[model samples]
Target: MYNQAMVIGKFYPPHAGHAHLVTTAAAQSGKVAVLVLGSRFESITVEERVKWLAAEFDDVDGVEIIGMRNDCPEDYHSDEIWKAQTELMRLALKSHGVTSIDAVFSSEEYGDRLAAVFGAEHVLVDPSRSAYPISGTLCREDLGASWPHIIAPARQEMATRIVVVGSESTGTTTLTKALTEHYRPRFPGIADVPEYGRQFTYEKFDTLRSVVPDAGIQDMVWTAEDFSVIGARQNEMENAAADVCPLVIADTDSLATTLWERYYLGEGSYGSYHAADVLPRRDLYLLTDHEGVAFEDDGWREGEHRRAEMTEWFKEALTAEGHSWILVTGDHDRRLKTAIETIDLIVAQRSGFTSPPWASRSSVARPALEGAAA
Candidate 1:
């Protein structure tokens, strides 16, 4: 008989201790299955809470938290339906290469019954930090008082993940969107930066012109640099929540701002404004070609050659800095297709697989799946 481990719990917000138990049980034998008793309903949706769990833990491996569909009436909890659910869990374990439950890991009352069903030994793990050793029902009633201490003890270390960056009107937004649509269904985790062009254009473009008059280069430069800083900071703070996230597709990286400062300043005024130290570092850089895509005529200086020149200059600067940048050109659809294909290489380099993001990046063993940025 194939050896297996069985674990069960409500895991309202499956904390670190529960995660540790799940991983340990799975490591003991062929497979480890976790049965979530009250997984379906709560104030917070089950799906929303699970994502929080994945971010809380760094990696998702060999852990399965099964949820049951609502086949019965919402007003009643049927014993017949629940017995069937438990039996289905047992069958699922057997079908998924689990023969015996090496241990039952829990800090709840149902721990014994969970082990007995599988004929597996029950192990009481140290629930040192769990909110309530008895159950979460009483504690959740007046959550305002006991909530913080229960689930979130204090601050936890965050994952310092990298974000991609580039310049505006330079295809940063399009590329990020393309990469997301390209790999969303295939990858376990993905991230992207918010697009500021449309936002800035829609909200502040007119107001700045009327008020500042001489807004000139300073105005546009301020807009670009300011947005760059905001975008990078926002990404770092949120993406830090997950561990081993697939990759973050940033709209505009820091170097783009450096390039902007270099472009606006005349006669080597690059050192006068600021240095490039503040820009957040990225694992990969994708430089976009300027093909006379968009133009700003009324407010700022406009020329086709100037746009192309800046694109060329930024690429050269990035190249000198020992960074990798892919030059993508053509219309939106054409450029998007090229970007999706090229990013496949970047993802491959990270995953250690030669196949594309569509064909690879996902694994049968990888459980605790989390969606990309919403």
Candidate 2:
């Protein structure tokens, strides 16, 4: 057992393989400092990487995850470049009062040299990739294919969220359900979050009926507080779905709630808009057009006459917010096809990541630096 051990990586997005390496180091050493090195060129920020890993290992004993910026160029053959990079690592550890590493844990070829620099013993773990058959490169190349390998926080962050919005009975629920079904075969855990606003409406109407015995949805008044509750619940459900699934199809989201509050309360409402302001990042907004689709009352909808006007409001709001959205028009089949194609394009585009400067060289053999390069 070593007194102190060190693990270094780029952890561009810490995956299962990276977790395995850190746990192995923690098991063998009294304490392990996992240094996440980031460069200006990478898309995944160093602070985000640190947060994800820290959350992943929060319950584990004596494992410290830290992040530092290392802009030094990658060169396996240059001693000067190695020295520059190693100094950043030393400073990151020293800030936490960690000194004199007894072991250096890595799955890369640089383990020997990194250990020598620290005057620690080199301990290699899963150099063959037999333990977890995944890498950051594979994850970057195809997020959908490598979805299962990514850690929970990264999975939530990378998950593609498609929010279906529009006027009442505009097939928002129908489309969200269809999209969820469409992706479930490839992404087994894919699921759609039902419209929480509708549920809130049902409860409100139910409560009203109990008091008057003849009260209808029309009789129930909508307050700013009601929309606030709906907005908060909508965001909660969407985030919970994203935590476990690669793709989340939300029937409606907090942003949609903001518009609904404006529609009902004559605009300038702060309750639901405040909820929308803090919502997690949403990928796409799909507006189900009310032009061709007939609105069905379903005993709960009171906005059939306002369908066209509401649709226009949604389009305007989405445009003003600079959110990516598409109007789904035509019959159900055509609409489904258009939505699928658009989403496929988004997934493909997200998967194609810009390689860090260190990975641009093909001659340099790729080693598992956890998520970094040595």
Candidate 3:
């Protein structure tokens, strides 16, 4: 076993192959430093890749993950470029008090030269790619097909999150369910997160009924704390769903729960509002319009007359919060079609990955770098 080892890669999305390389290094070394390199040309940020890998290997001992931006042009033939790249790698390793590496672990051919620079031996693993037939290039080319290969933390960031929210009886649940069904063929693990507020409401009322058998829905009191609980649970459920699927549909999100807090606990209430500020990023929101849709008088629902007003509140809050949203109208079928078209466009746009300069820098032009920023 080596005293100190190093692994270096762009990690782009950190697929299973990268994990294997890191784990292999960790197994053979007392200390393994994984350098996550990033370039401006790439879409995924260096910080995000570092965080994902850190989480992925949190349980593993002797693995240290570090992120650094390296915009140096890829020219293995040039001694000058090699010197500059090795200096950056050394600085990153030294930050973790690794003065020298005994071994350099990598799947690339340049591992020998990198190890020589650090006065370390080269240890190549899976040079033929037989162990895990995946790469950053393959993941960038077809993210959906490579979903299973990506680490869970990275998957959460890459997933296309669609949230359906609106006032009561406006078909938010129906639209979320339909959207999940629409994307299930391509994203088999995709699922719609049910409204936690509704479930909470059911339980709250049941608890009240246990004490007073004749208690009705109107007697149920909604406090700021209740909305906060709803908002937190919504975020947890959404995150759990996104971890397993590349696409996740939700009936409502924490952001929507804030407006409901105002609706039930008066306009000044901001308990749920602050709680939702730290929730995960959502890609698209579909607001179900209350027009032409008659409100159903469910025994638990008392918002038929206030549907339009609450719908307007959702629109205003969504815009105020700087979230991307679209209004869905007409019959259920038409709404589904409109949602599908919009989501398909978003998914297509997000899935297109720009390879780092190291991969295909010849075709792409990069601005001259003044100095090393990492």
Highest TM-score, which number?
Answer: 3
Better of 2 and 3 by TM-score: 3
Task: Give the alpha carbon lDDT tens digit for every residue of 26-116 in model 2.
Answer: 9988999999998877777889899889989999999999899877888889999889989999999999999789999998888999999
The clash count for each model shown is: 7, 3, 0
All models, RMSD in angstroms: 15.2, 5.2, 6.9
Clash pairs, candidate 1, are 4-100, 4-101, 5-102, 165-252, 165-253, 166-252, 166-253
How accurate locally, in lDDT, is each candidate? 0.49, 0.84, 0.85
Candidate topping lDDT: 3
Per-residue lDDT tens digits for candidate 3, residues 8-29, read 9999889888999999999999
Compute the lDDT for candidate 3.
Answer: 0.85
Query: Any runs in candidate 1 off by more than 4 Å, and if so which?
Result: 1-170, 187-191, 195-245, 266-281, 292-303, 331-334, 352-374
Cand. 3 TM to true fold: 0.86
Q: Relative to the unseen true structure, what is the C-alpha lDDT of residue 342 in candidate 2, on a scale of 0 to 100?
A: 88
**Tens-digit lDDT track of model 1 for 1-374:** 22556676545544444666666666664555665534333433445444444454335455655543322222114566557756666665656556566677765445676667667677666544232232233223322222222333111211122333444455666666777667656643554556443445445556776777766543654444554444455444434422324355666544554565465554443431232454433455666666646753444344445776777777787788877666767777876777667666654544331211221111211111111112
